[model samples]
Target: MNESALLAILLSLASAVGYALAAVGQSRLAAQGGGGMGQLLTRPLWWWAVGLNAAGALMHVAALHYGPLTLVQPLGALTLVAALPLSAYYARRRVTRREWRGAAWTLAGLTGLIAVTGPASPGDALSLSEALAIAAATALLLAFLVRAGAHSSRGTGLGHATASGIASGVASALTQTVTASLSHALPGGPLPWWGTSLVAVLVATFAVGGLLLSQAAYRGGLAAPLAVVNIANPAAAAVIGVALLGESFHGGPLGWLTAAASAAVAARGVIMLTGATPADLPTPLPTVLPTELPAPEPAVRITA
Candidate 1:
């Protein structure tokens, strides 16, 4: 990989860690039940979560500046691995064998994805009309998901978590477009004020909206919902990148097969961890991920 690709990978990792930490904090807040909106705003943890999320997003934009969406998107799944120890530390949760195994699978799949991808160079950005169309569609989808999530309280928050992932994924794609376009304008390219303003509104809307939805999804607990969110976010971004942004897979058929297989492995790991909570914690975690994570041999016991 070139320097740009390497830097993108590093930035993506930093962003993932930030997001993972933030999600843990948010999950803790959810565990406490509704703190009332005002009370929540007054809490230090809430601010930390919000601040970390914003920091992650800014870095994500930078990573997208140098990397292809496919490469950067998959790397975000590492957040789960990173979140494990944090979850344990904060919630006094034990790392179950199932959790470890799932984390291992997620790590393995992401590694394969990286190996298959090549260096990324800056690519085409979406035009105003195209972005607007995407924005409209995203808005409608999010509306439906939010309603589904609100009703999912007694059950798994899978629907809510999925919505967060989609919102976040779309925001990431638009961030790339806006970043490229604005950079182009900086070099004397024509800047359309209307386009700039419109996309900005949409980006802000989705970014903040995704964060809020993720907070709601955490009402149950953290594991399953986090996994779903991470997988969905990357999948959404990869689709938009390939279908609309003219991005393509780096390797040929063999590489594609590897990526597909790796993804399946990761998904399986997610399932293994779906309902496993700490023995000490009584409440179930909400299901899907914010930037989420791991690796290793058999240092820890593997349980069914």
Candidate 2:
């Protein structure tokens, strides 16, 4: 394989691992019955998960350096594929047949996407107006999520998951934008003042938003929200790349439409896996307290 392809594969694997670890950590947190942001940050395991995610993001950037946006962007969906088995292993939870079928569907769609997308060069520089627009849009979406999350009930896990997915997707998009802008600035010797400033703001925004969303998603169900975000993020980026960056597919418009349809199918699969009804999830085992087991003492006396 070529260097770009190798990088893409490696980065995709790294991202999958990172997301899996993050999912595990999140599941542990929820299992612990921890609530609120304060409780979350205190856990050492959560920190480790965050670090893993950061490492994954770094690998993703590296992949972008070597591969086309079209190829690199879609490969992120691999995280969704990886999360299921990893969660099962770590939590000792079994995935239902529905989940496996859903994952398969998602994988098939993403595979079609990768096959159809055409390679293209990234833009040399993002115009000032474009940077500002992206920043504004990201901010607006985040603000909306925060407002919505505030009103949502704690037990409504799916709501939290959806919000987190949206936040993570927006953050991922901003991160890509920053990466592209920085790359453009680097080739010109000294980075332009405006470009540097814009990139810095966007990077910070992306990182912070991504962190919060990830934490919330972890609080929800790691598998569901992570799956949702993984699918949504790449889909959004791919759309931007095609619409704004002039990227296209192999066999023209018909091929592009077919790839999109496949992606939708894949997305439906992911939703099916993670969007289990109450009956699907394991029920909490009832606790037996010492007081509740007092009958054991009487039995011992009778034996004596």
In TM-score terms, which candidate is top?
1
Candidate 1 lDDT, 164-234, residue by residue in tens? 88998888777766776777832334348777777888888888888888888778667767876777676
> How does candidate 1 score on lDDT?
0.76
What is each predicted model's overall lDDT from 0 to 1? 0.76, 0.65
Query: For residues 121-191, what per-residue lDDT tens digits would candidate 2 score against the true structure?
Result: 54433345555676677567666665666664333344455455555555555554556656664233434
Q: Look at candidate 1 and tell me the lDDT of residue 38.
A: 84
Q: Model 1, which residues run further than 4 Å from truth? A: 1-14, 35-38, 59-76, 110-123, 149-151, 154-156, 185-191, 278-304
Clash pairs, model 2 backbone:
106-266
- Model 1 Cα shift for residue 277 (angstroms): 2.8
